[model samples]
Target: MANYTDWNQALIDYFIKGTPHGTKIYLSVDEDVIERIGYHFGQSSTNVIWVNDFCIAVRIKVIFEGQVNLQHLKGRDSQGLPKGVAFLCATILAASQMAQEEKTSETNYFKRLREILALDGFARPLGMKFGNEAEEPLWREWNRWLMEDRFLPSAQRGGGAATYINYPISQSLLRRTDKDRLRKLFQEKQWQAEWDAQTLFAHVRREAGAFGIHLKDLLTENKQRHEAIVEALHQVYEQWKAQGCPTADKNNYCTWSRHLFCGLYRTEEPFLGQVDYYLYPKQQRGRSLESVEVKQGDNLHLLREERPGWYFPLEYSVSQKELDNGAKYQISSPNDLDYLILPARDFWILIPDAENPDSGAYASWQAPSLGTEFILLCKQELVSDIERLRDEHLLKSSCTPQPIFNNSGWVELQQCMVVSQAWDGVFIKNQALKDALQPSVKLLISFSGGLRVPKIGAWLVNHGPQITIFGFYSTAELKVTRLSDNQIILESSQSTNTSIRLDFSDPGHYLIEATFAGESSQRLVKIVDWDELAIEKYVHPEVMAINSEYHIFGSVIGQIF
Candidate 1:
């Protein structure tokens, strides 16, 4: 048998020497020759040869179940041929015979060979047929070796080389189970890691190539599937919105968009119930029975009984229009009213109207329960329909479901407000007092007399003037302190529309605290110096201007001094 060196030299002489660049040569050999070379020729295998600074691509085909009838080796016994030399002899004999055939006939004969070799690193095996049976497991194994064994460089290592054994997949060859497997494989995160959408699609396509499907066709089908899923989700959202967004429904809501009311709940399964109370802004009036306009400079004092009590004493005069519109006028002392509702912005203070009944009511108000509750009254069937759609369209399609907003599946309202006090409103609080006459309200803090710089979380003001802080819709006492020294700067006990003027002569940070009905909220105010300001200009050297004479010239750029 010829050794490796002798075989290599023989191949170089017969295939490479004097061959022109871009020339393609075909060699057909018997199965024994391929076995001798220790290479498996599927339908065809290709190798490259360099000649005179050019490449000659050689395609080798194995003639199975038939004798090649090579005229040059007619007298020789096939079994006696040397292992490596057999491949070289067969190649030379085939080339000499094919060179004399008509060029058009030769081209038509090797058209399938050209198609197989056109794909990168792809080769067709004798056992596999196009649009027919395919050895999918064998192809998948080769591809896995190419990827995991680093047969080609990895993209993660900054190499763009890709190699895969691909076959044309027909729809008839794909079983239902195979398609399901492909769907699950497409969603695998391991293959998707560090891969962009295009690269990921390519990888998936290569995997599908093992099963004989093309990337373009798969992408077209996937796009249609994705659109169907998005449409299904939209229909479910519209149905839920039309039904008043009930919180107690069995349907799972997803955070798909910001404008949807379900996004406010921020939970897949939100706690649903009915709100039993309403919040209304407190009515401010003068000492007289008529409504009064209380100004910032007014020194009016709100009178309350000095005895220990939760409800502050305030007089409410029924208007004549309200009485004429069938309003009830019930004459009852403080003892008859069982609950007193103090609807402040930050604090919805609920107290027993009776004089000092027990310590429980006082403890409930003073215990710092500052959470807001949201109750969604949803129709049960609407949510069930959404869940059904998700399972049918999303789950079966192998599309991952959107994650639950809160893992606990419970919705917590961060801020609450009361719409009106006259109507019986639903009050949902952290503590569920069935008879509790409280409404959810939010605090409003407005800052004026300064340039607000949101990026630095500070307010910029001149050194001499004071910045005014106003708490609107709040019956809260205002307190200001210098944070650096923790010194009290201002403290006022005004109830409605309280405004405090703070001098920011020095540049530093200050803390403003507002306490209303035992609930306090603190805000940080940063003082900064405003010495000088000017607009900056950037001039481009390439920019030219024309004078009145229509002469274009470069203009000099000047900087602000």
Candidate 2:
């Protein structure tokens, strides 16, 4: 097997081009650079060789490792691993090259040659941005915070150059899963010591977010953007292996664009479900309510209430003919009687139209729907007290859900839950699970669990809803009511060959439930709001890959120098 030295030599040779030539080149790292490249790997390095004979600068790197520990370097000791060395080398090289080429900064490929030499391999760049140098203390503090839980004294002082932060090595850290091992290297304040409860909880939440990704959905989206990214990375690696670890001349090769990398981890162990609750943001936008004009310096004390139904005095025009017609009762300017007035705070989130099956719009509000009784009609004073309790983390252990208002005046109504791992397990639940075997509801089945197979069959509920299956993906499938009415079908995807019957409309809840021949019934359909569904479109493999690749290509040109 070729060693690291062989890989390193090839990388160096690719840049030098065997013949001596000076080229102007610039290099950048992480997301700190103005030009974006791809998903930020934990560690990376780049070399820009300037050849006077050619206008294009050669960008090269020996991508020792990738974002998800794919390279498996597993280096021992605290001198830093291959990733660290690569990161350092890339940083120093890019900086030095930029300093030398301060006068002429553009590096463009003219496409003078076809079938250019391929580079060994590529990984996403760390791609971090840097601000004013004055913020070293803050970087030191953040670094310290990352290393040690202890805060720096200077950090307490507050004002300084602001610095952005990213965790390139978070995946590696997660793999270890050992507190004592960390203590040997990092300080007590750093990540070395035993994980703190709060910090550990934060990590769990972040990982939970990643678990939410659906690969098949990602692939089918926007020309298979996500698939393109994975394929691009795979191609680079495969090419490198085929060349017997030859050096890569970045300038000579046709480069693939960079797409941000997403982390993926899998666990098949079933997770149980239990009743739990959480406080969630109700809405980000404030509602448009009656505008009460106040003198510039008016106390506006009553504004503190800010709740609906608070009487405010105002004067406005009314028809005198109506008054003469014996209609003397007062009509509020911003009429409240006709409105089932919600607080200006929560109105934006309360999509009163959620019940509309045809609107396609999803609710913006996010709150625990189970294990919490939401009493919207309770007294305002009591509600205020509940919100206050939730904000300070005082109600974290409470049995009842608490309410809170985020900075945006969003009403965050929260409920309580008994802590359990089950709540975080599944992506979506089937409301009509009990009747899953009856065949009325359509269930998309993939025997291998791969979901790639498009073969499908329908189940007919002789007395009830006729199940029609169409949509297929990695995690879930879509089923529609089979009928032949034009107005019945709303969404294009769910209406492939199937149609909805307007005459036999069934309300309440339905399911596109999935069940294997021998396995237990499970619901793969994720009923998300229109916005969350929109995310499905973006994260889809096709969309992410193409956009990311284009971004990466541009970033390389700008930073390769």
Candidate 3:
């Protein structure tokens, strides 16, 4: 294996091939210069063939590390100012100011690039403007944030520098599973105990944000983007391995993007749901009902007495028209009602868009459905509360069977059981599994007590959501082992077809190894405890609907939804 020094040397030697890389290296970890005779051993030294080059690298690290002194900008002696900081100040500089500032005055480095979104040109005018910087408030804000060291580099803070966000670093920072892989590759242990790799990473992130650079997002999205990308990559790699690992040098020149197999770790994403709702923004205007405008400073509050278990966070809009007595009032944004969205559930989330096969009321956001636009969101652990809400008559009338948004394209809303595991080392032990992964040769191992799979939480979390048996199949050896302890639970020397339903009495994460020819493919499997999984998966609880006119306060009664 190539040592850490070889890797770092390659990054610097190969990446800084052009002027663009030279200009951008300040934003890269490659600029962190350190010299040692024995790999990651030995004391740090600045000895270098080119003194100026070493100086440049040192300077790049300092600025991004957030120790930038604004006053130092004026003290630099003419070698084109600090390289990185200067470029940033230039991008946002007012043209008039740029012209007035002295060329030798310190200014260097462009902040991380921000994408310019071209708005509706058809609806508005476009024009060109010039200056030391455009009057972009966003840039100003980023400038301030990146210039500080207060920002932490942990998962909560954007994990990577703005320039490198989305590029490996931030991706690792966003995902818990990616951290160990990155740390191992970077030889991060050499970092000072206090100013450790993580701390320095935070420093880089802090400075990037202070500079008003747009940090790429990982959490803003309800569904993660990386999971799908990794999954697809794994599938491709498996197919390639099963086909004999063809290479371009062998006259193959086939298309393939190779990715290192990072070890898999359990990952559980929170299940959440959102639905549009209506409410009275202001305090109840009992009996003497009259419309009142919610002022700019008005605080919207939810009536707690109305629903005991459900807590309403102020989130909706009201309409101007009168509540036209209609059964399905939640669908239309009538001028008569206030509109709002229900908060998403943090855990056990059951989005109720239940349209009774018989209820005369029908209300929908966009999907074809009818009922009060109510979603039942409760902690998965809150079994009693979830049960009570499911049984509530008023809630049943509001929340109904509706379309749930799942960006992952997984078959249905899955329970938090069976968390996702990061990529693991896949050993192609069989010839068919090595370089000839037939899409038809999929090895599916399902769990069932006997031969029959239980519908109880088994189907949703343990197996059957994705059908891998698309191509012809060959006999492959199958082994199921308990991951928590590495105990071999079951083993079969030969299995035909693409699917095999294996019974697993115990619940937890497992490792399923399927071997074809001589190669074997392994991936993580999570078998959630039936008890815990049952709560997340729906168990058809009875709920009554109170479809009638309701009162707002003690004195006022109106057709409120």
lDDT of 3 by residue, 1-561 (tens): 233223323333322221110011212221111121112222243233321333343334333332322233322224322223332222222111222222311121121111111122221112211221222222222322222211111111122232322221221211212222223322323321212111233323322332211122221121223222223223233323333443312221122222111100111122533332243221111011123222212453323321111222223332212111111112122233332222121221222212121222212111111111222222223333333333432123232223222331111122211111111233222211111111111233322222212322223334322212111244666676775687997777653433455555566655666666543444444455535542346554333333555544433444555
Write the candidate numbers in order of decreasing lDDT. 1, 3, 2
Q: What lDDT would each prediction earn against the true structure?
A: 0.29, 0.23, 0.27
Q: What is the lDDT of candidate 1?
A: 0.29
Model 3 spans > 4 angstroms off: 1-471, 494-499, 517-520, 526-561
lDDT of 2: 0.23
State the displacement of the C-alpha of residue 55, model 3, in Å, after optimal TM-score superposition. 19
Query: What is the C-alpha lDDT profile of model 1 across 1-561, one tens digit per residue?
Result: 333334433433332222221112212222222232322112143231112001012222223332211223212224332223333333223322233332413232233333322322223334334321332332332222222211211111111211111121111112223333444454342231222122233344445445433322333243312222222223233323333343323322221111111000011212553212211112110001112211112332232322211112223422223212212222122222111222111112232211222222221221111221222212222233223333432111112222212242212122222222221233222211211222222332334444544323355554322323232344667787775687887787655444445676666666665666544444456666664233447664554435433433245543322
- TM-scores vs. true structure, each candidate: 0.21, 0.17, 0.21
In candidate 1, stretches whose alpha carbon ends up further than 4 angstroms from where it belongs are 1-442, 461-474, 531-561
